[model samples]
Target: ADHRVSLPLAALLGAAFLPLADVAARVIDRPAETPVGILVAAAGSPFFILLARRIGRR
Candidate 1:
């Protein structure tokens, strides 16, 4: 019934999975495309920052 509790848990899960996913992708090393680690993070930084600021404002 508590949205706040679930939100934090989901965020924590996402934070944990992001790094793990990147690490696994790099290790896999596909022949077609080199595994890219942290590409999502790199691309998402700006959007994440903007989101954080907006959330902080509220």
Candidate 2:
């Protein structure tokens, strides 16, 4: 197991899932609103960084 490749790949997979979980929460017709943690994690994850960095992060 190569930490160099695997760790980043794991981080990326976790971060990618963060946003889907958020959307699922909001779309599931739950009584309560989505949790703050989910929203924060979705926005703050490296998935967002990966997206923005591709757009130059301006």
Candidate 3:
């Protein structure tokens, strides 16, 4: 889509998400903060690494 069409929709959706992201950021803001998404991503990384190692062993 053209920028004219997309920009308006993006602004509408972004406004809805902005408040939620702000709330999440506030919740996640801690001294030793580990974001939920990041922790999940890190947990996934080990699985991928193990898969790669198993493939290499073949």
Candidate 4:
């Protein structure tokens, strides 16, 4: 994949994902709030692991 395309796609996906994660943090705890970082890390860790593995293989 081209970096030109991949970078913009990643940026767009991040732009879309952040608000959804923020909403989830608010709703998940109901009367309270969960930290947005927790949700982001939970959602992102798998992808980061996968990327790390892919890079390691190269």
Candidate closest to the true structure, highest lDDT: 4
Q: Candidate 1 vs candidate 2: which has greater lDDT?
A: 2
Give Cα distance to truth, residue 30, candidate 1, Å. 6.3
Clash count for candidate 3 is 0
Best of the candidates, TM-score:
4
Q: Rate the local accuracy (lDDT) of all candidates.
A: 0.74, 0.76, 0.69, 0.97
* lDDT of each residue in 1-58, candidate 3, tens digit only: 5999999997898677656655565577665544556644554589889989999999
User: Between the candidate structures 1 and 2, which one is better when assessed by TM-score?
Assistant: 2
Query: In candidate 4, what are the lDDT values of residues 13-37, reduced to their tens digit?
Result: 9999999999999999999999999
TM-scores of the candidates are 0.49, 0.50, 0.41, 0.89
Judged by TM-score relative to the true structure, which candidate is superior, 3 or 4?
A: 4
What is the C-alpha lDDT profile of model 2 across 1-58, one tens digit per residue? 7999999997998788777777777766678767747666765688778978888956
> For candidate 2, what's the RMSD?
7.6
Roughly what TM-score does model 2 have, to 2 decimal places? Answer: 0.50
| Worst lDDT 10-window in candidate 3 | 31-40
- Model 1 RMSD in Å is 5.3
Error at 22, model 4, angstroms: 0.6
| Ranking of candidates on TM-score, top first | 4, 2, 1, 3
